[model samples]
Target: MKLHALSPLERQDLIKQYAKSFSERAKQHDEEQSFPFENIEELKMIGYTSLSLPKTLGGQGIPLTEWLKLQELIATADGSTSLSIGWHMGIVSELNQKNWPDSVLTHVTKKISQNGFLLNTAATEPDTGSPTRGGKPTTQAKKVGSDWVLSGRKSFTSMVPALDFILVSASMDDDQVGYFLIEKGASGVRVEETWNTIAMRGTASHDLILENVKIPHDHLVELVVPGKKSPSGWLLHIPACYLGIAQAAQTEAVSFASTYSPNSLPGPIKDIPAVQSKIGENEADLIQARYLLYGVSAKWDAATDEERLEMQSELGVAKYHVVNAAQKIVDRAMRVVGAQSLFTSNPLQRYYRDVRAGLHNPPMDDRTLVLLAQSLFN
Candidate 1:
């Protein structure tokens, strides 16, 4: 079946086919700490990179529900790839709703569809943490005649090895922040090879270093407003990623239980009430988390722009629940496997570490709970 231009069932069928290969390679990617270059090549060759853009932009034109559902499938195969690609997909999805300069949008959209070019933001810095915390970026942008020169370092630049363009957050002379769109070929653009975390090693999330890279004035995508921007359904990718990891855990534990019979047991341990309970718990959490993800994405996709923007708290709550549930499911799966699950060869240990990273992803649990509680008072 063709990967694009399909009904939901066909899309999912194709997704499952690609997911199998991705899963087969995921453990190796983790072990070697290598970027899944083959996986990305296949994804691009199959047109997944442009999957989120509207049909008007020569893309599949799927709604948010469909987009996120497909993303979850990808994540189930390889969480790092899902997350690494999500930065690009989310930017593409958000562009459909924003009023970016038509010339720039036209160029970027064509790059995405024809060249498989991907974009990511280099926003976080060493001096200041996440830009979500409201600190001005340390990256500096100076006007050199009609062009802008950007200089600074950016942390947490996910998929740095694969990105063709980056939305770099930099401070202007006036102290207002501007997001400058820097092409990878810019004179001073470089990747610092700084990402060496215990989780998501396949992401290649290194530091972006800039030293007076020059681009046209229009390269400035937008000026920072320094307050709460509108909530985005596209960010649902983060929750979907962790949830997919949990799904993988569920598959591993269930499979192990079904085949690994011990002398103490009459049959496979899946027959045990304790094993069944753990399986049941994982199943329950997966179902509930899926509801939160797909339901909110569908609602967000179907609503008016204002209605969608108003769903910040609800979306955050949904993300919070899914992340927490995924973490629990992974823990339960590990428990079901006993000490064996901790082995380096087992994927469950990877899932355990990967799922924990979700807690620190955007819309942090503490912030999400505050948003949930603030809505209560309002």
Candidate 2:
């Protein structure tokens, strides 16, 4: 369909078509706690996986606002799949804009375009906590003859089942933290099925066990100054996913209210003043959060590199507002649906669990608040 040539709205319509089927299958995946590999494959078939690459590199090079909108649409169908693939999308988008070597960028983007390859960074560990908190990795990487051998375990390695590449963070012999790009099927690399949370279970975010996995020296992609990461506007996809989930909850609640008639009621509960008020509040919250998210995204897409560096706090602020609003929206939706929303058959239950996962994603709420405070002082 030459998706890259389509207008943003046209492309979104195409995604909506695909997402309808995804919405149908979401229940099965959630019930089985199974990863949605088929959904990922379908997205690949339509070239959605490579949409975030630079236009000069044979991709759409979609703007941040448009990219996040597509992500939200996908999340409205299935939050776990939306989140699993969003990491690949946002990481590819972010790295392509960085100062990584030209050859490396070309190689990575080529695989994405040609093979539907996926990549994600594995940084979290039981001892070190969230990578954003600046804990040094206990995972050790030692210099072998012409390669680096990494041996350690990484927690919360999302999309591990389908990942073609994993950028692992390891502490080097020199006490430096290096991100090594390790290919799947590398010697001694194994996945331990440790992800069993009540939320986002379909992400397959298992423990990645690396036992002396060796990669070429050039594959040590980047070194980090502990506790420091450039502000990532691409992280807005996290909020976008939750917003979709919230919207899904809203839809479910409204539909349920409109049709659910009890012996005690004159008609569907949707006509009740209290139910209408809850629906109104949900809509208002969605409007507020969407404006903030898209507004920040538009500003980001139009900003130059130097200007974007100063937008870190603004980006975090958007995330904070959007995620918390999503949580509230879901809660209100459950109230609108009454006890039925908690039933295993209800999608709202899944939405409730999935939205909670957003709070634990990068750029925690506390950190966002601290950044806002420090910005005023500065």
What is the TM-score of each predicted model, taking all chains together? 0.97, 0.97
TM-score of 1: 0.97
Model 1 / residue 294 / CA error / Å: 0.9
Clash-forming residue pairs, model 2: none
Per-residue lDDT over 1-378 for candidate 2, one digit per residue giving the tens place of the 0 to 100 score: 746668899999999999998999999998888999999998988888888877776677889899899999999999998999999988888665556567776787789888889989999999999999999999999999998899999999999999998989999988899888888899999999998899998999999999988888788888897689888888999999999999999999889999999989989999899999999999999999999999999999999999999899889989999999999999999999988888999999999999999999989999999988987898
Stretches of model 2 off by over 4 angstroms after superposition: 101-103
lDDT of 1 by residue, 1-378 (tens): 446767877888888898899999999999888889888887887778888887787677677787678778888889999999888888887677656678887888899888889988888889988777777888899999999998899999999888998999888998788888888778998888887888998999999999989999888878776444788888999998998899999999999999989999899999999999999999999999998889898898889977977899889988899999999999999999999999999999998888888998888889888877888898
Candidate 1 weakest ten by summed lDDT: 221-230
